[model samples]
Target: MPKDVYVDQDECTSCGQCADNLPEVFAMDDDDLAYVVDGGNTAAGEDAIQEEIDQCPGECIHWKE
Candidate 1:
């Protein structure tokens, strides 16, 4: 599977839902924007990331290669 967590800064609300769901992947930056911390660096690619995506109120998460 490809990278499953993506945060569109323009659309992100910085609600912390993604980080709350999966801290191993999602992280909030100093600017309060969400980003994939482990993205392509970890084995956690799809399932957990999908859960975070589903829980994001802003629906800012996406999965793509």
Candidate 2:
């Protein structure tokens, strides 16, 4: 439903951009890495999540549709 959400840990700088943009979908862990919240809740905020992915400074976010 939401395609495939992917985060490239190698390029991620833990900037929190994704989480900031889409708190409903993304969150920062103790490691400061951004991750999508699970439990089959990913597709609910598709547009906002996609916007966050596009805004990621490190180019680490992707949606494979």
Candidate 3:
């Protein structure tokens, strides 16, 4: 099954890594925090997104349960 992606706003540092690395699945809001695009779910890019999750400095990215 596909998983939903999200960024913990409180832990977010408004970094652009998510948007810069995965524009197809993530974007920055007006506040500059990364947010998942397109309903926050994707069947593809699991490995790519996981890379983001691993490399995120703030470690705010997550897969929704």
Best by TM-score: 3
lDDT for model 2, please. 0.74
The Cα local distance difference test for each model comes to 0.75, 0.74, 0.83
TM-score for all predictions?
A: 0.78, 0.76, 0.87
Query: Model 3, 1-65: lDDT tens per residue?
Result: 77778889789888798888888888898998888887546734678889999999999999888
Clashes of each: 0, 0, 0
Error of 3 at 28 (Å): 0.6
Sort by lDDT, best first: what order?
Answer: 3, 1, 2
Q: Write the per-residue lDDT of candidate 1 for residues 1-65, one digit (tens) a residue.
A: 36444688778998988877677777899999988785432647577777777878888888755
> Which TM-score value belongs to model 1?
0.78
lDDT of the structure predicted as candidate 3: 0.83
| Candidate 2 lDDT, 1-65, residue by residue in tens | 55767677778899987777677667788888887777424644667767777789998887765
Error of 3 at 5 (Å): 1.2
